[model samples]
Target: MEPLVQDGEAVAIEQEAPGDVAARDMLLDRAMGPRWRKKTSQKIRQGRRPADGLAFVARSADGGLAATVRLWNIEAGIDPFGRPVPALLLGPLAIDPALKGCGVGAALMRHAIAEAARLGHGAVLLVGDAPYYERFGFTCAKTGAIALPGPVERERFLAVELVEGWLDGAAGMVVPTGRYVTKSRVRATAIAA
Candidate 1:
């Protein structure tokens, strides 16, 4: 992705690299508070690698992580025919406190969604402020029948279909289906225990 200039500061949106782990965690903690780890969204992302090419980070001109977003592979319950419905789960989009209004977050959102569609994904689901995410086409319209593994505000569960009607009739509890990180790989990357 190309670099974006927000308020005279050049910000680059790029793939989340291995070296970005620590900075990404710190930024997430600061933006979402320590309790963020306990959120239902975290449950679906735990121990999984992000959907291929779907993790992104925004960096300021100084090379500091400014914002981040990732999508994970998930089973959005089942369709009317009882087949597992595949979808992408997007979440924990965090921005540096100082850059909240600088368009960094929006840039990352657009980049992530576009990348997901380009990669042939069918739909994206997320738990977030409807008003904020709606501008990006996220809505509770197709999510009424969808449920997370844990409690989530009904109004906050949303979805945006990349392929029209991809989520039609999707229902039940959303669960993680992304590739799991092996213990050795986790230790080597220091991403988790």
Candidate 2:
């Protein structure tokens, strides 16, 4: 199918076709850096489809997967001090080496964020360089009540609340959907009330 073209650039975002299995693997294998490759591979092995959680891919002029991103369910917001909120988590954002600096990553991010907002997601969270993500309106997750499944530096864990005041008085850990359910310390025994 033809790509979604705009701003003098020929691009497309669409449902991944069955014929894309090989292409998808290739992109995933190279685009994700070392820190994320293992987790990404595990997800693939578990038979997760990009579309299962709003994964959208950016294709190049040649119809190649230049970039891809997935929106997973994550809890974010305030602490018991009154600042936790739930938000869709965006992560493992990857860009094809050849397509780097060509705006593929940016396009994918914009599209994903827009889609999440359209779906009524209260917010979006991710771990990444603050400088790079700041341009997209993401800020260091204040309220500090959330933690990842594993160790993560504070500064890099950022988020963008879709509704301005959505996270104003909420608190909780941001856990992967189904991976944690207590609404408390996802890795421990904390709970939200």
Candidate 3:
């Protein structure tokens, strides 16, 4: 991904690396506060690996983490016939408090969304501010019939289809379908349950 320049600072967007784990977690905590782990999205992500090649981060010119976003594999819902609807769940897109509104978050979002499309994902679901995500083509148009495992503000549920009509008839409860992380890895990562 390309570096984004904002207010004379250059922030490079890149794939999340092993070394970025601690920094990313700290950044997320700082940006979202301690309660972020209890969100409904976390329930779906617990014990699962982010979809392959979908986790990303932004680093400032000083090499400090600036922002992060990740997409998880999920079943949006089962169709009437009962087959799981495969989709991507995006969440916890956090930017360092200092970097908020500096375009780092936007850059990372664009990169992640484009990469997901490149990887042939059909759609992306998220619970977020409709105003912010709408700029990325996300809306609740197709998410009305979809349900998460826990409570979420109705207006906050959103989706954007990469392949036109991929979510046309999607309905039922959204469920985690990503590869499970090993117990040891989960313990090391301390993934929120």
Candidate 4:
């Protein structure tokens, strides 16, 4: 059922249409099912926020949505060589569960990467499986030199270079873009309350 396109043809993967949040929510609900809630319940998810970088979804030639992916702007900090790691953060990349095994996810991922690269990003950072992400040239950042406030699979905190070897001299911790500061403020208020 994993099809890259209808009959091996390329599907037009593009940035989500204007005001597609509802559709994105619905898609996540359907694709993730109950697993979404449990994962959302984790406190770590609160502390460790991925920055919004870019998003792409697979659509039929008729414009019917098939799958989705999103990116966030995040910082990987400075590397051993005092260089900053500029990265596009990706997450909640869901393909309709029904579309699992189909090439929808792959198409969206490829398109997303291409878009970010076109936008001049240094790398992509995501929390995902080693075996799964390996297909896209990603590797675990266990020794990566970035820190996370919450728990994540050591091997799953990964980064992929948009420019070959972009990470060679960069090292540091990942932090949510501006959103993290907002969340921190909210948390602080809650604590004071």
Q: What tens-digit string does per-residue lDDT give for candidate 2 at 19-78? A: 554565567668764446455223322322232447677776777777777777655645
Clashes of 3: 0
Candidate 1 structure, TM-score to reference: 0.96
Q: What does candidate 3's lDDT look like per residue over 71-117, in tens digits?
A: 99999987677788899999889999988888888889999999999
TM for candidate 3 is: 0.95
Report the C-alpha lDDT of model 4 over 27-101, residue by residue, as the tens digit. Answer: 877887746635522223344433344766776655666788777776677766676666666767887665678
Those runs of model 3 whose alpha carbons end farther than 4 Å from true positions after fitting are 191-193
Q: For each predicted model, how many residue pairs clash, with residues at least 3 apart or on different chains?
A: 0, 18, 0, 16
In terms of lDDT, the poorest run of 10 residues in model 3 is 184-193
lDDT sort, best first: 1, 3, 4, 2
Give TM per candidate: 0.96, 0.73, 0.95, 0.74
- Badly placed stretches (over 4 Å) of model 2 are 1-9, 18-22, 39-53, 77-84, 178-193
Per-residue C-alpha lDDT of model 1 across residues 4-104, encoded as one tens digit per residue: 99999899999999788778888988998888889999998988999999999999989999999999999998999999999999988999999998889
Name the regions of candidate 1 deviating beyond 4 angstroms: 188-193
- How do these models rank on TM-score, best leading? 1, 3, 4, 2
CA-lDDT, candidates in order: 0.92, 0.65, 0.91, 0.66
Point out the worst 10-residue segment of candidate 4 by lDDT.
40-49
Which residue pairs does candidate 1 place in steric collision? none
At residue 99, candidate 2 shows an lDDT of: 65
By TM-score, is 3 or 4 better?
3
Candidate 3: global Cα-lDDT?
0.91
